[model samples]
Target: MPTSENTFHLGLTMAGAVSAGCYTSGVIDYLFEVLDLWEKAKRGNVQGIDQNLVPKHNVIIDAMGGTSAGGMTTIISTLYALKGKLKPVKKIPENPMENQNVLYDSWVHLDDNEEKTFKKIWDVDDLDGELTSLFNSKVIDAIATKALDMGGDVNDFESYVSENLPRFISKDLEILLSHTLLRGIPLSVDFKTEIARRLKNSPMHNTFEHYLVSHFKLNSGNPVNENSYLWFNPFKEKYSDKIKLSTISTGAFPIGLAYRKFDNTQFSDEYIKSVTRRVIFGDFGSENPDVNHDIELNNYPENYSSISVDGGAINNEPYREVGSILRSKFHKDENEYQNYGLIMIDPFPDNDDIERKYKEPKNLLKVVPAIIQTLWNQAKVKRKEMLEQYNHDFFKGVIYPIKHRIINGEYKGRDKNPIISASFNAFGGFLDVNFRVHDFFLGRNNARNFVQYFGCIPYDPDNGNVHPIHREWTNEMVEKFKVSRRGDERIFLPIIPDLNLLLEGKEPGDDKYNYTYKGKPKYNPSELFKLKDNIYNRFKKVLDKGFDSFGEKTEEESETPISDALIRREYRRNWFQRMGDNVKSWVVGKFKNPVKKAIASMLSKFVIKSILEDLEQMEVLDDKAN
Candidate 1:
């Protein structure tokens, strides 16, 4: 047996390697959810390029000359510097190519017609006037859609972003100067044509770059012998430089840029919409990550129109009604729940003289489903916790009375009663931890599976140690808490000295493997974690399947699987005491219950007061120049 000191330290080091797997599972769930929605949308042959498959709170609008409720998040972040938003500390380097003083109305564009929307030019390169207009109108989504097709020329993107970007910066460019609404942003770095040719044949770093192969999903699962990590953190030390935190748009779905091409020149934006406006069934993309240009799509919940393979225009009476513009893109397997949706977008009509290409694929819509679920579910779960956590001990210890007196200007004290108390206000609080989709492609997982390490760190009211809102804490915190408390995880980790190295055909105790854990040959530590995850997942599947004995299970099932909360709460209470010792709670003697009237009155006060504050400080958050 290993000594206590060695045993605990050994556990921590070992768990780190396998910790990613658990996080990966969570992230993969989101990835699949996103891919499923996008694939379905693409297969359904959805119209607009801005269709979002994620969950958001914004109203769906007709922007970018079409309809979409999402993508603003990505556009906002990418255009952040365009709006002068300050970057967070220790974040990726900011792109200094464009000005940060402008802001755009995200919901509306300049005009539908290209000529009427004639924009000016301001680029170092001579790509001006009509050419600049073409790029902004053609390349930048600006207001309407948010997907970028970096297909034809990586050089064009490199130059546009590097040199001529100022040309497209509109008058109102500050729309994204604040925290954006979209969740995860996928940055596209296209490798095609000249770009592909140069890199594929390069000799010096070609071998290393080749090793950094692209990972794809859509296959039921992943295969070994490939670079297979899917749940990726752009913030990871190894790939931090390659992953630009500032540039990662919340608009992107998959963490990495997907590759696609428009095969026909006639398949212009207006033509495709007008052409398939009434089509029934269409194929778009498939479940295979490597497969594209194979799927087609048409309106769903409507009759599948007979699409002529020769394909020019629809001749079928122009009266076939597709029932509902159903969210046909959510190609979820039975196991995956409909956590969120991909909005069906509208297409632009041919009132504009823009060259229409029905054959060539102009833009691609990406999906980050697990992130959608993460944000959506967090909103729900965190909202519940916020309500529950407060309600349980709310209006206690006369804090409310003291605060009320101060708000009404009745109380005046420096130390005892601060004039402005942030305790009651939630303006600046740590975001809830529900690591939705931290990374689309995690380590060696083929970028298909979503992954994130979640589950709240142990908090002690006596000790002010707590988790910050909306941030990913270090794995070290979890390990410390787990081992300190002898958690099921810490207790269960097996003894494995060189578990990771063992995979490389090296024997334990040969190099750094010979190290002792208290006294024992550090047993394969990773096996414990693998076992734990396997056991947990198996149990989850069992519960999801409903009953142990098929239909024999009743509504009041004899037994229920233990919840994380239950275990932690019980432990806390047993170790100290619930309702009496560990937690402090007090009941007010003169508590009034005109609860309805007071609640309504309070809400009215909050709204009016908040509006006044907003009006007074419109530029409180304005960005200062560098």
Candidate 2:
């Protein structure tokens, strides 16, 4: 509910990351906290709220779009935003040290009865008769359990025996095989069915449908003759449904490759070959694959109906959706909001590094999987290139490039765009509790840093006004700061001062006296004065409290999560490391329970001590600087 004179028409587009979406959820958790968008919605108020309200204040968002796993993020996050369930269960203290205590204490200390902080942000209650069902219910568990249970029917012992073993086999042998081969049926069909069923049952689903319908109405009458706000890339043209949007958007390979209900389409040999070529080489083939990209909604079948798959197969990063929607908004005379920006959050920035084997496949067995991987990698690379261009072109927006490691590399439009980096060890599996906890905190802390340094005011497009905690700088002011510090070499420093007197229209002279340049200077006198004043004011605002504290390390910035050591070292492990660890863990579990327990206990203590020492060392560094 934050109000701002420089309010932004924020449009968000998230990048897909399979299980790594836990990290993305953490990012959204913190963003919602800063925006203070946790107020619950009442009956009839949730739907059509964005259009009904006058163009007066920041609401939830102007447009919500993503692909594959990111599409799931859009649905889940938007659901939370609408239901007013985004606030953190634990209060974040004002004191930095106190905040650190909350973070570490929650993770390190044991609490079985109480829900973990990460689970709170990620889980929501199932909507039933209870009005507070969402408050107490855990969303991830509910959906996962239902998806697993109803996804496939349980196989009976007789059926299993008949399917896998010969009828002539001995009764005892058949029973043994049945017990060993006790697996359920294929889950893809059931999984999609479960997702649709849940959506249909929930009232929030109705609210979301209303929201989309309203957007469709607003975007329909435009002169461009295209829908502006809502989009999802289905494979074949079909009828659109609010319930199906979430399902279709998430129907990528592995998850929903056989989702053939809407189109009655089969993955024939020729169809796959053609699809692979387009996916791997892009629309124009390898020579000019990057140009004339064909995944935008504009290229969709003339009708709104279509059976879809994971949109990532076509466009992994749907940032163009933001651009397209904003353009439509800009052209619409009825649209009242002036300021606009895209908040593009990419969870899988490093996915381009997931390459296929450089050498040719050794056998026919590896060919199909290899081709699929090559296609995936090539598609990701193309979209990543497009994302880079999008960021450069839309330099007035906000960008969150979540990373697994902290680095000093300069991002595109650093001086123009409000780019905030949230780094942490995102190696934990998708449903890992420890990873979710650490990731949530990592996101929250970095969000605090964003508000402190960049001063991005969070605006909700569906809701009304909330005051901003701090002021944000305009592009002109930021450009001047870069110009004034043109010669400064320091990289880690957040703020830099003018290094040359000539830039300020002053002559370089001896220490004894100051000299003003009477001759024509490099810059206009008035411009130079304004630059100096801006730099001085920025320094006062950012660094007056303490220079050392300006860029002091937070938990995410300083060290990898403790869970990284205990659960998985990192996400980028090679096949050998993964196989070795699996074998080693199995061996230890089977033969050395005591040894495994001892190692875990010792490792936990060692990691905790190391973290404390590192934090203390940072404090000492701060003290010495002061």
Give the top-scoring candidate (lDDT): 2
For candidate 2, the per-residue lDDT at 258 reads 23
Model 1 segments beyond 4 Å from truth?
Answer: 1-140, 143-146, 150-615, 618-626
Task: List, residue by residue over 442-524, the lDDT tens digit for candidate 2.
Answer: 44444434333333333332353222211243333233322212463321111111122212333212111111111111211
State the lDDT at 216 in candidate 1.
15
Model 2: weakest 10-residue lDDT segment is: 173-182
> Model 2 Cα displacement at 21 (Å)?
2.9
Provide TM-scores for the models.
Answer: 0.18, 0.38
* Best candidate according to TM-score: 2
Give all candidate RMSDs, comma-separated: 31.9, 25.1
Location of the lowest summed lDDT over 10 successive residues in candidate 1: 10-19
Please list the C-alpha lDDT of all candidates, in the order they appear: 0.22, 0.34
C-alpha positional error of residue 466 in candidate 2 after TM-score superposition, expressed in Å: 24
